[model samples]
Target: METPALEVQLQTLPSSPGVYQYYDKNQKILYVGKAKNLKKRVTSYFTKRHDSHRIGVMVKKIKEIKHIVVESETDALLLENNLIKKHQPRFNVMLKDDKTYPWICIKNERFPRVFPTRKLVKDGSEYYGPFTSFKTVNTLLDLIKGLYKLRTCNYDLSEEKIRNGKYKVCLEYHLGNCKGPCEAKQPEAEYNSNIEAIRQIVKGNFKESLQQFREQMKQHAEKMEFEDAQRIKNKIDVLENYQAKSTVVNPKITNVDVFSIVSDEGYGYVNFLQLSHGAIIRSHTIEMKKKLDETDEELLELAITEIRQRFSSKSKEIYVPFKVDAGEDVKVTIPKLGDKKKIVELSQRNAKYYRQERFKQMKIVDPDRHVKRIMAQMKEDLRLQVAPTHIECFDNSNIQGTNPVAACVVFKNGKPSKKDYRKFNIKTVEGPDDFASMEEVVFRRYKRLLNEGEDLPQLVIVDGGKGQLSSGVKALEALGLRGKIAIIGIAKRLEEIFYPGDSIPLYLDKKSETLKIIQQLRNEAHRFGITFHRNKRSKSALNTELEEISGIGEKTVIELLKQFRSVKRIKEASEKELAEVIGVSKAAIIYKYYKSKKET
Candidate 1:
């Protein structure tokens, strides 16, 4: 078999964590993205239909797949961010934030000052965070200040400065906010211990700070210093609340990856969440086409491997919705309780939402794929040997036992084919007999198709329950087509589907596409049948009115109707006007008959 040009490149993609870049034919970088498995992510661009027109266009313009494999997901994220900044790929999200995000800088100097700065200096200073917003930086700074008073001044509290007596106790010392470290009133070792505790808090470890505060609270209480004890108690409350909010999930459940899967008949969606210190650092969802009817476990295993490798996940543990073999080097946990389970559930919700979003996009972008999925689903739901690509639905229209008729609506590829629709005038069936009418119409429809060597429908639907279905089955049997073509009936009440020789009806889901199409077919048949029946009744009433006239036969009635169009118009016509359409002798009979009736 001849291989596609890009197939070789895609098939050889490294299933390891990496950052992939797409370039246009002109060698201009179009987009940059990070993946744990390069092959899976790159292949998705070619294999899956994107709901995003921009992404779709970008994919079409891609001339080459260039990737840089990394060691871990964090490395990939940093690499992707750096590449996006360096190259400014057209398809990447254009971040308008030129101003550097705030970071808590513990300045590298004597009596290091802890403060927020938008600039990073590689001067041996310990920087804690690059907060997304200034407010977050401020919150952390305020929390640190409240817990332990650090110096706000930029003065260097070195031994020479203290010996020279260059500085005195400041207002901060008087206010008890600082230990007066500028004037050597505070011991360096004691101040350094406080700095170490602050370092732990900034690193998102609150146990040390909380434990020290609890001991202080107990010491003050032992001394009967109630006010001091209560003050310490308040600080502990603030620390506890801050820690509670910061660790949204269990702090113990750190450095873990969560995976969940949601799927339909044709495609599967998988969501991956990368967490650090109980916080989600990265989230991604990918769409995968199911070629071999893979099970959930199989798809999830495949997704986990691809995503982990693409992102270069080094996390020893992972949380999943179900148990799966994720290599012997990694531990796969199906979280059943607490924060672990909740994260897994959250992953599932993300997968479901992604699937729903893709569905909406596919409906508008690739309607053919949507239709095919629906057809495949219906074929399975109906348990038919083949999809009902060409369907014929029969509905009998008999009102008050007059002008009984039936309509057969044709649906090709799940849509009404009005050109192939047919109407039947009940010939052999007696008045108001729906079963007999259905039998006559179904037999005539198939018998003529067979006689003319035309293709018969894949499925036949009668708009009724068991009785009407049996009638249709009998007609198909007489025509030697009982098992050749699949047939069923739908009843108006309760929207139930009935199969021939089956007592119980099959009730499909209310929101199922299969049921929706069936309902559309049944409704179309009824509408078409009713319309034909109304026209037949109206024509019959008009013809009968003229045929009742003395000496007026069927041919003469038709002749007058062909010209005057209605009985009222024929009655208003003069003998001369009537003669124009039916000749003199026939015109005289019609004219005389109406005139005598008016006189009476």
Candidate 2:
């Protein structure tokens, strides 16, 4: 970021309010900001003599800039919030938080009771707020409970007293907490009216509801109900305090979601903060990964696209990690001032924290400078005469006797090479024959490596015991690559490590770092292989019954399977529900056959 470049970007910006983006030399987003006057705001960063060290650092890294001119300052503010959330750039003040908004859920029942909740349920309950503060929401709930005398207990009074003939209403009525309509102590009409009034307050009708409460308070005082009047006044005060603290909304900016993406090396994290009518509502994070060799520009490009595909199409504006290369559907920019600036700065702070955490995990003071210790550990544990630059592990997957597959996952240094992962469909092995599958996969893999004249792996690992290890050795022997590549086998529990022709399994000391690294690699390979295998098996199971059904061709069977998960669920469905399934009709002869089988 330089003064001349800042001036150049500011000169081109529109006067309208929107988001702005500042990018570093590697084209990573350095900072995101929102501005009311884009030109005036962006230019401030260049001319300000008393800029803080954080801003100075950001300015140094900035090589490129971008902006989006939105409808109003409020839109700019919201878009800025979204971008900061998405990018988490490096020069902002972020609120220390994971606190989500709370909502008041009115249970769907004969006697509905309002409850405070963070998660919204789809079971016909009316959810409100997603209030800024949990304490405020709770206070309101308490006020409603005190004023209405509604049953706070979740237990069903009607079901308990009427249907089951259970216990009687006890203390709630005597203590004035509940109306006790369960035993007809209070009239249904009065209780229902109070419930409706509570609904009004939850719906944000504070002004009207306050007047009604005051009128009721006056009536209670006339009847010498001093305590009741005081309670009503307290409820009114709670509503006023909450309303005063909420952000004032500008009519133009009704709904907006802010996003920010921060990347360092090959890793990135996206933060999302949502606002409705200028009130902060929702927030989330998205983590990204790249190869250790990947550049900042390359990583940011992928991260922005991923964030857009996931969160942008549904949102009005897309705040990004850096200015996109162009041809994006939504506008992107960095904020220069106002509300959006605060959000962008916050995002930067979070990104800095995220990057720092990643650096700590890498542990090395200078990761670029390879240590001799790392190389030595790699050589001895893999049992290669030379240090292994690349390690490849293999595993076999199948369910009983079906959909067998083998996986080969590669690792560079100690991390996964996801791009080099390969899967083999077992063409020869039937049932859960791990040994045969290992042999076939090993032969096919190495045969290609040799034919292609590719660099041979210094080490090869198979996730199995002696039988699979022997199969791997035989495959390598057939290819004349047996001694060229060092092979090792990992066994579970008592049998830890095995190699072909070894008298006993080899167990590394528990305290060895080399063993820990190898175990991690082995677990990752097994996990990847098992996940693919199980998915294939499940698909096979779902296809089996459909394939065997007479009069059900592949197309019709595919349609039915897609609509219903299993044959059993489909059979249990009524004729009407069955007819609604694609390619199924009441008049179709196939329907009659399925119905006959269901009855039998």
Winning model by lDDT: 1
How much does each candidate deviate from the true structure in C-alpha RMSD?
A: 12.7, 24.3
State the lDDT of candidate 1 residue by residue for 1-600, as single tens digits. 213656777888899988899888799999887776888888888888754456677778888778999988657766776786689887764422244556788889888889998777899998865555678778878888887877888787789998899888788879888988778888888878888988877656677889999999999999999999999999999998887775367767777989999876667888988777656645678776654355687667667766775555788999998887676567889888988988999889998888788878888999888778877878878878787889999999888889999999999989999999999999997679989988999999999999999999989999988889999999999999989999999999899888878898899989777899999999999999999999899878866687777787888877877887878999999999999888899899989988998999
Candidate 2: residue 179 Cα off by (Å): 74
The whole-model C-alpha lDDT of candidate 2 against the native structure comes to 0.68
**What overall lDDT, based on C-alpha atoms, would model 1 receive against the true structure?**
0.82
Q: Give Cα distance to truth, residue 114, candidate 2, Å.
A: 67
| Positional deviation of residue 445's Cα in model 1 after best superposition, in angstroms | 0.8
lDDT of 2 by residue, 437-499 (tens): 999999999999888988888788898888889999999999999888989888877537887
TM-score for each of the candidates: 0.50, 0.38
Give Cα distance to truth, residue 444, candidate 2, Å: 1.3
Local error of candidate 1 at 225, Å?
35
TM-score of 1: 0.50
